[model samples]
Target: MADSKERLASSLLELKKYQEQNNTGVVRGSSTLGRTHLQRLVENGWLEPVMKGWYIPSSPEDVGTTSVWYANYWNFIVEYCNSRYGDDWSLTAEESLTIHSGNMVVPTQIVIRSTKATNNVVELKYGHSLLEISTSPASEVAFDPIYGIRLYGIAEALMFSSPNYFKSDPVNARANLASLENSAQIIRLASVNGNSSRVGRIIGALKNIGRDNIADEVLKFMQRLGYDIRVEDPFDNIVKVSASQSPYVSRIRLLWEKMRGQILSMNLNLSRIDLKDKDSVLRSMETNYVKDAYHSLSIEGYRVTESLIERVRSGAWNPDAEDTDRRNALAARGYYQAFMRLQKSMATCLEGDKFDLESELNEWHYELFDPCVQAGIISPADLIGYRTMQVYIKGSKHTPLPVNAVNSSIGALCEMIEEEKDGFIKAVLGHFFFVYIHPYMDGNGRTARFLMNMLLCSSGYSWIVVPVERRNEYMQSL
Candidate 1:
């Protein structure tokens, strides 16, 4: 019995060593990682099953267990898709552009067009699924070597994408369309495939986005091919999308533009205050802390009461002091710490100073989770950086961007916040984009609300405490 236990521990150590040596989170089930060992590792929380035969490494102390999912979404998909279809599969046009634009949010259903596909759905954990469409791609469909997967060529994708793509992801959609140096490739496809409808849709998208020359050229070339083409604007309206050559920048621009309208329509009854009214605002924050902590913690599903928060704030919190649930108590403590830091951050933002706001938010995220680290609920590394895996919001269809998108999105977000003239937009959108990105493994919502209030303070609005009861409405509004 003793020898068996020792051998299992040895296997665990070897697994960790192998992961470090390979510098990869992916662990495939094999002879060494047998069913018994895999089940044992999962039971101990050191490995999480990404799919039936795959797993990603985990920290035993990490309470928020979705780290592996966010960190390895693409890797798992690429691998799983290959195993299922060999080389006969291609990702859909929209998803390819989503990746191209650095918006790697785990889509609820990844659309894979493949010749050998079963046309079935592969259900994954956390409401994510793989949707296989059995369609034979044209012979001209080319794949990029860098993306490590097969997809339709830029021109083919643009020609085949749904019209709804223009409104939902106009920046990426337009950027991709504008990126094709010439319509020669698409025209060749039209000539070869004799697909007039696809050519017409492409022309409409191009013309709608102000690419009249390309649209006209495509029209002429397709006509020269002796095909009568009918074209209509794919999108409802012709939106002048602003974008530079950088696809990442364009993605950020599109996301901001899309959400800004909703922010304007939000509860605008909150009166604006003077930024110089520091003392008055500080006093109000002092009064609002207890109420804010309770709701904030409650919204996060922490069973914390105002009384418990008051106790924690008053230096009466002792995780080891009683039969109290230490986890909840520590969470309250962390929230108080984060709340205080936010007050200081608000002061700085209002004082007309320029500091690296990114690091400042990093500090806030670290503060929010510091107690969890100390309580041995999560490792110290979880607070040190952004999430590594895909995350899905409960009951929400929107999937956040991949880890690759986090830094660029935040950079663009910070730039927008500083340049915007409307404080309302800055405050509301700042909060919206932060959580939309979901950069951290946990505490994203709480941290976002704090940052929102900081932006609001800059514009002279009081802290808005969303009661726990309205969590559903709040999420739905978002």
Candidate 2:
């Protein structure tokens, strides 16, 4: 008879083969032999039970991990959907938009669509839930071959989703729509009409492009059918007209006016200070630098003090000191380390041929954390955890970006900053984008502030620190 170890090894090999093929529903028998095998697999940390009778391959990293439930979620959902629904399962329009935006901030309740009825809210482990809603008769769905699932078209997606989804914080909603990098998708959305009343509202919500004509045409067609269409353009402060008032005409007209206003007000000029002389420029630069440092630290959730600033200025700051001043010392050291790294990054950028901002920023990040990582002040694992902890707040919803995407977004942002000519705009955008990307496991806000100062320094501007009092405004600006 085979020993327990031999049996365990055999069970592991079978499980691995199943996982490799992306098969999740294959049942191991419920006999004594099967129960023993599964128990051994779980005990040995080779498998994790996702739900009843379902198992996922587990790595050493997966044991006792609570933070990255979304990663595990994506894995389980992909497996579960494939096993149960095959190609019949699909994400809702809003979920599709979230995916299309390269946003990994998983929704609290993932909305999906299927031919079969499911519970409106299905709770998952780790405080996440999935809401599966049936698509309306007027809704249109299309197959996304990439994921082998059907999803609502952009036009259908906008129309079918709640108006509250677009109306909350109109600026961000408009920004998200405007920043859509895919032109073909936009055109496709513009071409579809009469699918949903929400399409008219979506057209009104879009910021850039002269697609009002298309929307107008669609609205005219919808109005001919006597649908009670009301366009909700949140960006405009116009009078709310009744739907009885030419709904199509009023909505499209207001959207066009708003679009024109946005186009006219799109300021590309970088803010500049009037310096009387080189000395004045130098003084202003210093002031801005200090301001930037203070604000950056404040935003990063630090309580800055004069002593900490002094230590940072002096170069004798230490994070591992065990005195009463340790916290302050650590803050000071972290600030200085970030500052020096920024200096080195800027210098490297100045010397480089390709103007590679992303590469330089990444190099700076490594340099900034090297000392802490080496001295055991913070471990490599913690550093990784810090980067993964970045959360993006959309209205009241907080979405955490996956670790892998954070790195990519950071690199992309650096490339964008390198292309910008306006120093103030560069600084502001860099700071916003860095925090938005949340690249590192931790220290992202500090790193971002350092980046802001570096950009300001390059252009002969002062460091601008945000005070703790203005934290709300700081986050709002971002």
What are the per-residue Cα lDDT tens digits for candidate 1 across 27-96?
7775546767777777777787767778776657753455557656666777677767887787887777
Q: Assess every candidate by TM-score.
A: 0.69, 0.53
Worst lDDT 10-window in candidate 2:
241-250
Runs of candidate 1 with Cα error greater than 4 angstroms are 1-83, 98-111, 117-134, 138-150, 153-155, 162-172, 178-233, 244-249, 263-270, 274-276, 319-325, 370-385, 388-398
- What local lDDT does model 2 show for residue 236? 43
Q: Write the per-residue lDDT of candidate 2 for residues 1-478, one digit (tens) a residue.
A: 9988898889877676655664442333344237776788778866666557665556555665543344455546655665655556678766654454444445667766665536577677667776766544224555442233456654455555676765543332342454433334444554454444465566565422334444465556566666555655644442322121121222222333344455347765545544335445445544554455555665665666665676667765665666545655565555556565665555544444355666556655665566666666777666442364434342313244445455545554565566666666667667766665566655666677767776876665655666778887766665
The worst-scoring run of ten residues by lDDT in candidate 1 lies at: 138-147
Cα lDDT of candidate 1 equals 0.76
Count clashing residue pairs per candidate.
7, 18
Clashes of 2: 18
